[model samples]
Target: MSFFYNYSANNQGLEIEGVQGQSVFSVAKGKVVYIGDTFKNYGKLIIIKHANNYLSMYGFNKNIFIKLNDQVSENQKISTIGCLDNNLSKLYFEIRFKGNPINLLKLFPNIKLKQH
Candidate 1:
């Protein structure tokens, strides 16, 4: 998991470094709300809306397996990790509640985010 930074800093997500083409999974069961790279600096991004006004985001994907409005299950493979302009393979993951970013590490204390 990445270090914490205030929302205004634009560091609202966790960067999970991994090998190129590694699988990326949905954090929970949700409906795909957005699927595109239009968001600046978030390459090939996918957003899912979960219950109780929660949202999950997966970014920097090499390939996306699901489409917009797709109902995805927990742990479902959504995409493959992609490289940024610097050529580093990573997945930018985030969770939000009511439009505010939440600390993932605090929420899943025992979960491992890094991939080798």
Candidate 2:
């Protein structure tokens, strides 16, 4: 789904469905600022702060391999894909600038997003 997808709660990111346990990689090099499952709806989440006041979020992770404050490189395996209550596996990703959500497609025009 696109970042602007509307649901019960506003979707602030892009969602990519995949098989359970698929690898999830970081989009850029940054510090792992937050990593936890506290947000019930997000599952195990990881937020990275990058250069130029950008932040990337990776949600619905089954397992997170890195810890907070760790430096991560682009394409690094950070977590495994997680499933929803109905057993649908997906990765919820977002990129924010100055605390506002930005459309992933607008930023990465080369990405071919799947439409459901």
Candidate 3:
């Protein structure tokens, strides 16, 4: 599917605008298979395995509320937005099929944030 950010700032992974304590919701039904902080640029991260062998990756979260193997529904709250090492709040989202990253924006045209 498509990914949507709640803000109008730059869409770059490092430049995205994420508000602290804001809930990060699941875009679709899936099973959480990974949840933890990354050692590098990703910060906190979570991975959800969806139907048809699709996986959604949510990174730069302040906290991960769900655990591995947890079933999550569409729009379900999963985590809170976090920041980089520089302390800039941002969420890095991705959709993958099998193991490859897919451009999710193509799937949700209506929800895309406009460029300023």
Candidate 4:
């Protein structure tokens, strides 16, 4: 599964601020299986295979600093933030459990969003 953000005239991917030039750290210690441009729209992407048959996808990366089969530590920088073909600088992040997409926000209870 995938989550899509509305792209209006002003709503660019860069809306996800504080992530620009920020390290795309690994959520957990894992082994990198694929790194590089896997999707055209995503620009550069990286996939990590972790324990318990889990995998994470990070897309829209400006640069990929890791290689296939490379071991990555938890919170390690694997790639830099980038934009889609539409020039939206957003980081497409996803967590898959057995090839199923899960809401990443549910995993972190400490992160709270202010009410509008």
Candidate 5:
């Protein structure tokens, strides 16, 4: 039962800002599929493959706890928000089903997101 405040996302995923040192957790148990820091705009990025043909991406992370092909459990801490432009740290998260983007809230009904 995790929650986020003051966040926004478009059709692709949720954009959470001002979460500097907060811990980013794995939404569901899965195996690390990809981990890289080549996204010019997103900084370090991590991708995980879960059951039911689902995938989760965590972008712009400051630190990563697991490596590629590692197994992770639901709610496991994977990374922390990374510093962005102007020294502001934020997190970019996405959930996809069969390679198609899906609303995280709709995908995981228990996690709550409230914008202020």
Candidate 6:
């Protein structure tokens, strides 16, 4: 790991560490906009566009169930947790309002996100 990566953790998005095979769900109702590993450190990523110009990103996914333009519901199963390394998986989740990353928990205060 580089020195920047170690220090940049604070600025990065939320990380939910877990093992493989854990289910990953859509945090909001939206249409699947993009899916792939374009973000190098994120492994497999999914970007969904929701109403009111909000976007939710579910990253580090191993198995994806939704495709481009697919209508997704809140809490719907979208994928399975993916490896962050050779032995562990994690979900790197975030929210964006008009393309600006925002504090996810501040917006979804009551969301009961699962942990591993």
Instruction: Write candidate 5's Cα lDDT for 84-106 as tens digits.
Output: 87796778788888988886676
Residue pairs with colliding backbones in model 5 are none
For model 1, residues 30-88, the per-residue Cα lDDT tens digits are: 99999998986779999999999999988889989999999999999999999888998
lDDT of each: 0.84, 0.83, 0.73, 0.68, 0.81, 0.77
In the predicted model 1, the residue pairs found to clash are none
Residue-level lDDT tens digits of model 2 in 43-113: 88999999999999988999889999999999999999988999888888888898888866666776665
Alpha carbon lDDT at 115, candidate 4 = 25
Error of 2 at 115 (Å): 6.2
Q: What is the Cα-based TM-score of model 6? A: 0.79
Q: After the best TM-score superposition of candidate 1, give how far the Cα of residue 96 lies from its true spot, in angstroms.
A: 0.3
Candidate 1, lDDT over the whole model: 0.84
**Reference-based TM-score of each model:** 0.84, 0.84, 0.76, 0.71, 0.78, 0.79
lDDT of 3 by residue, 1-116 (tens): 22344342322221246677778999899999888765455677888999999888888888787889999999999999876667657777877788866644566556546342
> Of the pair 1 and 4, which is ahead by TM-score?
1
lDDT of 6 by residue, 1-115 (tens): 0011111433335777666878988888989999999988778999999999988887789989989999999999999988766676677777778887786566656655554
> Which regions of candidate 6 fall more than 4 Å away from where they truly are?
1-12, 108-116
Model 5 local distance difference test score: 0.81
Tens digit per residue, CA lDDT, model 4, 1-116:
12344243422221233345666788899999877765665567688999998888877778788889999999888877875555545676667878776655567445444321
* Model 4 regions lying over 4 Å from their true place: 1-15, 18-20, 109-116
Query: What clash pairs does model 3 have?
Result: none
